[model samples]
Structure formats: C-alpha cells, structure tokens
Target: MKKFALIFVVVLSLVLVGCGANSDKASNEKKEEAKTITFQSEDGKIEVPAKPKRVVVLSSYTGDLINLGVNIVGADSWSFDNANFKDALKDAKEVSEEDVEGIIALKPDLIIGSSTMKNKDKLKKVAPVVTFTYNKLNYLDQHIAVGKAVNKEKEATEWANDFEKRAEEAGNEIKAKIGENASVSVAESYDKQMYVFGDNWGRGTEVLYQAMKLKMPDSVKNSALEAGYYAISPEELGNYTGDYLVLSRQSSGDNSFMKTTAYQDIPAVKNNRVLEVESSKFYFNDATTLEYQLKTFEDFFLGK
Candidate 1:
C-alpha cells in the first residue's frame, strides 16, 4: 500500500509542474500578440507595432520624436547639425533616402520619412512606412501631426502649449527691455549666395518675429516674408538690413563679404547689433532648436 501511495504522489507532482509551464507559455504568447497595432498612415491603412520598439527615420524631423521621448534607431544624415539630436544620434546608422535594403537590415518596426523619398515601394516592403509633407501645414501644426504618428500626441500638445506660453512671456519681456517697435532681420551667406528670411525660416525668425514681437524691416516683410525667403546680391544687402541682424556665415574666414564697403554700410552692423550665429544651428526651425535660440537671445539682448 505504501509503495503504491509513493508512485501516485510522484505522478501528481509531475502533472502540477507541466500545468505551470503551459500557463507561462500561454501568457507569453498573449503578451507578444499585444505588441503590434494598426496605424492609419498617409499611404493607407497599415499595421505597425505599438510604441514601435525600433523606428527608422529618414527626415529632418528626428528632433520631433526625440522631444517626445521615442526610441529612434536610425535617421537621415541631413540633421547632423541639429543640436538636440547630434549627440543622441551620433551612433545611429545613417540611411539614405533610397536605402530600402539598408533600412531593412536595421530591423525597424516602422519607418518615417518625407513624401518625396525615393523607392517608397521598396521601403514599404520592409516595414510600415509613414510619410509627411511638412509644407502642407504650418511649423507647429506639423509638429502636432508628427506627434500623432508616434502615439505621443498628449506629450506633444503639452509641450506645444508650454512653449507658446513661454514664447509669449519672453516676447513681452523683450518688448519691455528694447521697446515694442524694435526691428530685427535674419540673413545668411551660403556658397556666395545671400538669403533673407521672414518669421517662418529657421534663422531666428520665430524668436524675432513670433516670440519677441520684433518688427521686420519693410523690405524684408515685403520680400522674404511673403515668399518665405528672398535671395539678393551682395550689393543689395542694405535693402534688407534692420535695427538688428541675425548673421549666419556658412564658410569660416570668408570675411571678404563683410570687409566690403557695401557690407559695412548696413545700419545694423554700424550700430553693433549684428548677432552672429552658426549656420548649422540656425537652420532648424523646430521647437527644440527654437529653445536654444531663446536662450541665446536672453544673453545677447537682455544681458541675462
């Protein structure tokens, strides 16, 4: 009787162990099933992993996702100078617009890019692809759209609202310090070409016009602001110069243009209100870059 009882007890122990193992496997399967999601992309209805574990971005909007605390696995090489992304993306793989195979090897669960990317069909084969047409919406609106794509809309809205309030406060402070009618202009010299910008372009316009409430020179408002940007010859520089100038020189040691008699004749340069900025940093118009520009303004304009 004792030997029979021992055999039965051993069999019962084995059965309990097997049941536990099966339960664990089933739980793990359920967890894996929940990892994916269906996203309505610009291309059409496509399914992507929720909170995508690996994302490959092929646009300058990498900063947008980073600000939302998303994991970025790869990105385009164009945004190398964006201060917010440079350090974090330093070790990230650099993928080209047409590198579908390259992106596939990265094992991305989702791909984000511009609508103009080459080989869109090939990219879609590897993973779900979402493309953005940045020009269709204003800058802040574009950021919100990107946030929706990454499932970070709540954080994005909070940041946008906070940023707007801060910007308005900063603008009011500037007016109090420098008078409400102070004028500012953004200009850059690139490859022997000069550009004048309005409030939309990256070169401090958001801070100067939108945030600080500074006035643009009539020539700039009539030209650059209407068309987004205006290209002018070296001799025509004075036409766009304002009470303050945000000068971004692309090449170092090319003081040739600045040394010219025509350049020194600008009223801003004569009065020493020219704020020299690195072209690379000033080229991004996103909220992250705009914060950097704000800090710079605090120091330069208010002596804070």
Candidate 2:
C-alpha cells in the first residue's frame, strides 16, 4: 500500500509539471505572435516584423527613421557623424556596410540601406534588409518608401505633406525677398574638383531649385540637369554660376578657387550672394538636413 501511494504521488507531480510547461509554452507562443510578422521587402518577398522594434540602419537614411519617430539600435558611421543625429545615435552601435558579424551581433529585426551594399546578401542571414536605390528617387519619395517598408506609411505621408507646405511657404518668402527672377546655382568643391548640381542632389540644390522654386542658371540647366550634375573646370565656372551661389566645401582643400580670377568674376560672388555650407551638413537628403537647409536659406534670404 505504501509503494502504491508513492507511485501515485510521483505520477501526480509529473502531470502538474507537464501542465506548467505547456502553459509556459503557450504564453511564449502568444508573445511571439504579438511581436513578429512576415512583410514585403525591397529584395523580393522577404519576411519582416510588421513593426520592427530593433532597427539597424546601414545607410545614410538614419535621419529619415528619426523623423518617423522610430527607435534605432544600430547604424553606420555616417548617422553617428551627423551633428543633429549624434545625440540620438549616441547609444546606437555602429555597423559597417560589410560587417555581417557586427550586424548579426546586434540581433536587429530590420535593416535598411541602399541596394549597393556589398554584403547585402550576407546580411540577409541575420535580418530582413530593405534596400533603396540611392539617389534614384526624390527626397520626399525616398522618405515615403522607407515609411512604407517600415509599416509607417501614414506617418511618413503626414511628415512629407508638412514638409512640402513648409517648403512652399519658405520658398515664397525667399522669392519675395530675393526677387522672382533671381537664378540660384549649387556648386560643390571636393579635392579641388568642382561640380554643378541639379535640383535633386544633396548639396542645397533641392531647397534652392525644387523647394524654393528658384531658377537654375541656363548654363547649369543645360549642362547639369540632364546628368543631374556636371563637372566643370574652375576657369569655365562662370557659365554655371548664377545670381545666387551655394558653395559646398568637403574639406579645407585648395580654397584658391574662391580667389581665382574666374571665380571672383562671377556676379554672385562679387555681390556677396554666396552661401558657404559644410559638405557633411549638406550632403544628406533626409529630413534633418532639409530642415537645416531651409533654416539657412531663411536666415540668408530673409536677412535675419
């Protein structure tokens, strides 16, 4: 009787343990159901979380995510280097374009960047990587695409609308102040090489030509618009230089271009219509940089 009673107790104990284990498994399954989802991605039909909690952005669009109010866990060095994004990305880990091990270590739910990333295939083993054609779309469209990829298309649309409205207002103000007919040109110098930009390039061309509705020089339009940008020798810079000039400097490099007889002879340079902005600050087409671009124009054009 004693042996039989001990056997019964042991069986009852085993049954309770099994029930507890089943309950825990159900709870875990529910939690997982709440967290993950299979969604579409740029690289064909890839599975991703419906709403990613841990995002690793391996591109320059980190500011676009910040504008959408998303939490980021990892990013490339460019995101950390932006002065406006430094504080927000301070705690974020850095992952390189080729760093599959580093990216996997972060255990990110979503990864986003340009399609040109060399290790994109390898990175896929770690997480769903969404790729965008770099510089293929306009800034607003780029943001919208990113938003859709992250399941935040509505938020991105609202932001894009607000940005357009603000840009139009600012453009009107600038046009009113600077005159309707004034032509603006965007030019950048890197390592003593000069290039004229179209409206879509990151170097203030968007604000100067597209947002503000400013006119581009005929020479610039003819030369740079088709290719989106055109390289020009400093001696021939006068052709592309318009009434208002935006000069972007990547490094201190030979600023002798500014003192060149060809450069100084331009009417904009003579009239002090040149706005000098840092290349790092102006080389991005994201929301943060756009805001900075607008503010700079307002201050300069409004004479504030």
Candidate 3:
C-alpha cells in the first residue's frame, strides 16, 4: 500500500508543474497579441506598436507629440530650441536621421518624421516608421492625426474644439477693439533675408488669420498667400507691414535696420504696432505653440 501511494504522489506533482508551464506560455502569447496596431500613414498602412513606450520624433512635430503625452526618447535638434518644450525634453537626447546607431542605442519603439526625409529605408529596420506630409492635413487635422497614431484621438479632438471656441471669442473681441478692417501681418527677419507669412505658415499665422479671422494685408496676400511665405529684401519689409505687425526675429539678431528711416516710417512702426516675438518660439504650429500664439495675440490686441 505504501509503494502505490508514492507513485500516485509523484504523478500528481508532475501534473501541477505542467499546468504552470502552460499558463506562463499562454500569458506570453497574450502579450504578443496586444503588441501592435495597424496605422494608416500618408503613404500606406503599416503595423506600429499599439502603446509605444519610446518614440523618436525627427521633424517639427515634436510639440504635437509633447501635447499628446508621448514619451520621447530622442528628438531632432530643433525640438530642443522650443521654449515650450524645454522642461518636457530636458531628459531626451538630441538625435537626427544622421544618427542611426544613436537611435538604435535608444531602442525606440516608433519613429515619426516628415515625408521629405531621406532615411526611411534605414529607420524601418530599427522600428516601425510613420511619416506625415506637411500641410497635407490642415494644422488642426494634423494634431488629430497624431492623436490617432498614439491612441489619443478623443483627447486631441477635445482640445481642438476648445481652441476653436476660445479663438473665435477672442477674435470677435479683438475685432471690436481694432476695427473690422484692420489688417495683421506676420514677418520674420532671418540671417540675410526677410520673410512674410500668410494664413497657414507658423509664427502665429494660423491663430492670427485662420483661427482669429484677422485680415491679411493685400501685399502679403499677393506675395505669400499661395506660397505660404515670401522671401524679400529688408527694404521691402515696410510694404508688407499691416496695421498690426507680428515680427519674429532671433533674440541676438542684427536688427539695426529698425532705426533706419525706411523702416521707422512704416505706418505700423510709426504707431508702435509691431509685436516682437522670439523666432524660435513662434516658428511651430503645434498645440503648445497655438496656445502661446492665442495668449500673445489677446494681449497685443485687447490689452488683456
């Protein structure tokens, strides 16, 4: 009787061990099943991680990703320059398309970049890659598209709706103060050339024209409306100055031309209607940037 009992006990122990092994295998399979999702890119559909823990952004969409609450492991150099992104990106490493080995070391789960990038083939080997055509979707749609990629569409939509309402109300109040026909122009001075922007270009152009429904100066419309921006000489700057001018220039840039008679004599300059913004701060059209633009315009127009 004792010998028979020992054999039965051994058999029961083996059965229990096998059950535990099967359970662990099943758990691992479930994790693999939940790993990825199908993302529709501008080019075509591709499989991407459903919940990307580490994302590397290679273009100007850094601010868009920041607002969507993605964990950025690596980003382009330009992202670091954004005032709004300073705190959020403090821990992130600066990387570009040129840094393939560096990006590999970071082990990003996903990558986002512009369609114009040249290293798509190499990046795909490291992880899933998705690219967006700039302005292919309008500024608001672009944010929504980003949310979709990161599984935060609802949050993105909510923010977009709120911004629209706030911008509309602000626009009405600003129009009342500045008059309906008062025009607004956004101009930027770079190293050697000056650029005038239209409704879609950054530098608060979207908030000023697209969201706030502000008027664009005819000279700006003719030169920059279709092309987004027009490069012109410094002497031509006065022609583009509207009743209100939003000027974007580097903080330490040479702006001595502002003292010249040609620049001072512009109607807007004479009236002190130019609102100077740091070029790097106003160069992007992302949620963080749009918020800054909205507040800046509100202060400039209504003194609020």
For every candidate, C-alpha RMSD to the true structure in Å: 6.3, 8.3, 6.4
* Native-to-model Cα distance after best TM-score fit, residue 176 in candidate 2, in Å: 1.5
Position 234, candidate 1: lDDT:
73
Model 2: per-residue Cα lDDT at residue 123: 78
For model 3, name the residue pairs that clash: none
Please give, for residues 206-242, the per-residue lDDT of candidate 3 as tens digits. 8889988999999999999999999988888989989
Of candidates 3 and 1, the better by lDDT: 3
- Which candidate number maximizes TM-score? 3
TM-score on alpha carbons, each prediction: 0.84, 0.84, 0.88
Question: Per-residue alpha-carbon lDDT of model 2 for 62-162, expressed as tens digits?
Answer: 88888887789898887776777877787789888788888888888899988888887787788788898878778888888888877788998888888
Lowest lDDT 10-mer window, candidate 2? 34-43
User: Arrange candidates by lDDT, highest first: which order?
Assistant: 3, 2, 1
Clash-forming residue pairs, model 1: none
Tell me the lDDT of candidate 1.
0.79
Cα-based RMSD of candidate 3: 6.4
- For residues 88-183, could you state the per-residue lDDT of candidate 1 as single tens digits? 677678888777778888998888888888888888888888898755666677677777777767788888878777877887887788777888
Give the C-alpha miss distance for residue 57 in model 3, angstroms: 0.5
